[model samples]
Target: MATKRFAPTPTPSLLSSFTTRPCCLNTSLRALLPATRPFSSTPTPQNWLTPKRGESSKSRKGKPHVATGGSVRGTTLVWGDYGLRLRSHDRRISAHQLKVADETIRKRLRGTKYRLYHRVNANIGVYTSGNDQRMGKGKGSFDYWACRVPVSRILFELKGDVHEQVVRDAMRLAGNKLPGLYEFVRKGDPPVMGITKVGLVGNSEEFLRRPRVPVEAPSLPHTAQRIPGTTPV
Candidate 1:
C-alpha cells in the first residue's frame, strides 16, 4: 500500500494563531458584523450634574463681604429695605407730627423777626429774635439753635415722662440751655410767645394774661315815673 501522506495536522498554537493577532481578527470580524448592532447597553445622557440646593451658579465672586456694624461715610438709607441700614443714633419722628409742628411755627412767626431751621432727624433749631433775612445768610453772630436742650423740657413736651429726665441730664452735661420754646410747651397751657429778647419788656405773668375789657349796660329810666301819676306799682 502507498504510504499515507496526509498534510501534517496543524499544531494547536497554529490553529489558534488569530487569537494572538487581536487587531487583525477584530478588523475582519467587525466588517462581517451587522451595522445596526446595539453599540452599548448604557442609559441615555442624564442632567444629574445640575446645581443642588444652596448652590448658586451666578454668585458674586469679586465683591468683599461687608459685616454688620460697618460704618461707611456718605451712605444713605435704602427705603423699604426693612431698616437694614438704619443707624442706631438716628432719631425717628412721625410725619404727621412734623407737618403739624412746621405749620404751627410758620403761622406763629408770620411777619415776625425770626426764622426756623429744620435740622436733620426732625430736630427744630430756632433763631430766636434773629433778623429774618440775615438769619441763615451770614456767619454766626446772633442767637442760634443748638443741639443741647434740657432733657426735662424735651421729655415733658415732646416725649413726656419717658424722655424728660434723660434729655435734662444730657443738656446739663453739655452746659447748654434748653430750647426757648419750652416755656410755651406746657401740657395744660395754650401756646404762648416763645423766648425772644425783643419781647422781654413785660413780665412773664402779665404777658400770659389777656387784657380785660369793660362793658356798660343800656341806661333806661322807668316810663311809669315819667307818665304823670301812672300807678307806681
Candidate 2:
C-alpha cells in the first residue's frame, strides 16, 4: 500500500508539444532617434507677417500676431546699475543684422569680465522682397528673412562692471553694423526721451551723456553672413 504514493500526471497544456522562447529585457528593440530636418539655405518667406482674411474665429481665434521686433514682452532687462544699452528711435531691427551687431559687440567686449545680453528677442520671423520685384503684390512675396526693431526699444544690454568708453565703442560698432541708427543709453535715463547717455564713467557728465554723432548712419552687409553665436571671452 506504499502510502498510496504516486506522481500526478502533468496538465494537458503543459504537456503539449508547443514551445515558447524565454522573455528577455535586453532583447527589446533599440529606441529610435527623433527625426530632424536641415535648415534650407534660402528659407521660404511664409505669410507670417499677417493672417489670411476670412478664417472663422474658431481657426483664427487665440492666435496672436507674432512679434517681429520690440522689447521682450514682460521683461525689464538692462535695468541694473551701470549696465549699458543700445536704443532705436525709429523702425524695427532685423535678425540677420542683429546677429551681425551681436558679433560686433562680442568682438569689442572680448577679454573682459562683462557679459553681453540681448534685451530684445529676435525669434520673430520677418520677410524681405525679392530682387527687382514689382511693388504692391502682398509685401513682395516674402523675399528674405529679418527681425523688427521697434522705436524707443532697447536692442542689446551689457551686464556687469564695464568701461563706459568700451560700451560706447561697442554700441557704435553695433549701431553702425545694423540697418538703422541707434543711440547708446545708460541706466536711470528717463524713458525714451530721445536723450541717450554715452560717457558716464570718465570726463564731463553732460559730455558723456550726449556726444555729437551723425544720424542715419548705415551699415553695409557682409558679402557672406557672419557666424552667429560668438561667446564672451
Candidate 3:
C-alpha cells in the first residue's frame, strides 16, 4: 500500500502592492509623501562668517598705513617701535578661540601702554547634534560660534611703546591657545621663513594638506639681545 502526499499553501503578508489602483491597499502610504525638513541639524543664521546687524567691521584693503605697513597705528612716536605682528601660517582660528587669545594677551599687557588691534573677524556660526533623529530632515541646531582666519592674514597688532620682551611674552601667551602656526615678527621685521617640508621622498613619504615644519608654535618668549626688555614694574 502507498500513502498520498499533499502540498502546503502560502500565507498572505500584512503589506500588499498593486500595479493598478485598488479600492483597498495594505500598508501606510504616509511615508511616501514629501515632508519639510532642514538641510542641516544646526540652526543657521541669516548670515554667517560676516558682520552681523549693527556690527562694525574695520575694512582695510592693503595695510593700515602705506608707509608703516599696518604694523603701527595711532601712537607711532611712543609704542610704535615695539609691537608683535601675528599672521596665520596655517589653520584657521575660531571666534571663541580668538576671544580667548585676545583676553590672554590683554591680561598680560595689563597696566602697560600696549594696545591691541584686531585684524581678523569671526563671522562663522556652526550647528550641531540632530544626528540621532531620523534621516531626511535638516541640519542640526546651532551649537557654537566660529570664525575663519585666512593664511598670511594679520590677526592682532600691538601698538604703543611696548617693550620687545613684554610683547614676546604676550605673543607666546596668546599663541599658546590659538590654532595654526604663528610667527612673532616685529613691526618692521621681514616675513618669517616658513619651515615647510613638502616634497615626497619614497613610498613611505606622506603628503600634507598644510605642510608646516612642526605643529608646535615657538616656545621662546624673546631673544636676550632685544630692545624694550621689560618695563620698570
Candidate 4:
C-alpha cells in the first residue's frame, strides 16, 4: 500500500505584477542602461606586441637604469607635445597592459587629429612554470611579452591640434590604466634624472653633470697597491 504524491502549486513572483512579460522587462532595462563599446574579442595584432621570431623566449629581469646609471635618456618628450612619464619605481609593463592604456587614450581622443608615439616596446619575454610543479624542469615556458620601464621614462607621447585640456584629460584616463604613478609632461620640460628634474631652478650645468661624472680612485702613494685577493686601493 503506497501513498499518493500531490503536485505542488505554483506561486507568482512579486515582480510578476509590474512586469508581465520577461522580454519587455529586459527591453526596458536595456533602454535604461548606457551603451558601451564592446571589448574586442579578436586577438591582439602580433605586429603591435609579439617579439620577433628567433628572439629569446625568456629574458633576465633587467633594470631600467641606463648604461649611464641615470634616468636621463627616454625621460623627456621628444616628438610629441605632451606625454605620460612614470614617476615611481621601475617595473616591467606587459604588452597587454600597454595595449589597454593605448586603447584608452585612442578611444578618448577619437575623432581628433593627433599622433600617438610609443616610446617603449614589449620586446622582453617573460616565462613562468605551472603551479605545484617541481623545480629543475627548466625556466618554464613563455608567458607574455613585457618592457622594462624605468622611473621618469615616457611611456606615450601625443601631439596634434587637439586642445591642451582635452589631451590632458585623455592622458589622465590612460594613466589610470597603467601601473605605477604617472605625471603629465609637456614638451620643453626639463629632463628627469632619477626622481629629480635636471636644469630646474639651479645651475643647469651642474645638474646635468652630476650623474655623468665617473667614479675615480683617490690619489695614493706609489707604495699603495691592490692587495692580493682584494679590491684595488
Best by TM-score: 4
Model 1 residue pairs with clashes: 151-167, 151-168, 152-168, 155-164
lDDT string, candidate 4, 50-144, tens digits: 76574644587677654355437888888999999998786888999999999999999999999999888898888888998798889887788
Residue 189, candidate 3: C-alpha displacement in angstroms: 2.7
| Highest lDDT against the true fold, candidate | 4
Against the reference, the lDDT scores of all candidates come to 0.33, 0.53, 0.54, 0.82
Question: Over the stretch 122-216, how does candidate 1's per-residue lDDT look in tens digits?
Answer: 22232334456564564333232222222111221122223334333432322222222222222332212222221245635444344656888
Off by over 4 Å in 1: 1-92, 119-233
Clashing pairs counted in every model: 4, 7, 19, 0
Over all chains combined, what TM-score does candidate 1 have?
Answer: 0.16
- Candidate 3 Cα errors over 4 Å, as ranges: 1-50, 54-90, 191-233
The better-scoring model by TM-score among 2 and 4 is 4
**Ten contiguous residues minimizing lDDT sum, candidate 4:** 9-18
Model 1 poorest ten-residue lDDT run: 78-87
- For every candidate in turn, the CA RMSD to the true structure comes to 30.2, 21.1, 23.8, 15.8
| Candidate 4, residue 214: lDDT | 84
The pairs that clash in candidate 4 are: none
- Candidate 1 Cα deviation (angstroms), residue 55: 28
Better of 1 and 3 by lDDT: 3
Per-residue alpha-carbon lDDT of candidate 2 for residues 1-233, written as tens digits (9 for 90 to 100): 46876899976443253445444222221113235656679967433333334223222112223333321341234544333343433455555676778889889888888766665544333445667777775443233234454544566778766788888888888888876656666665544323322233443344434546678866657854455786434
In model 3, which range of ten residues has the least summed lDDT?
59-68
- Which candidate would rank higher by lDDT, 2 or 3? 3
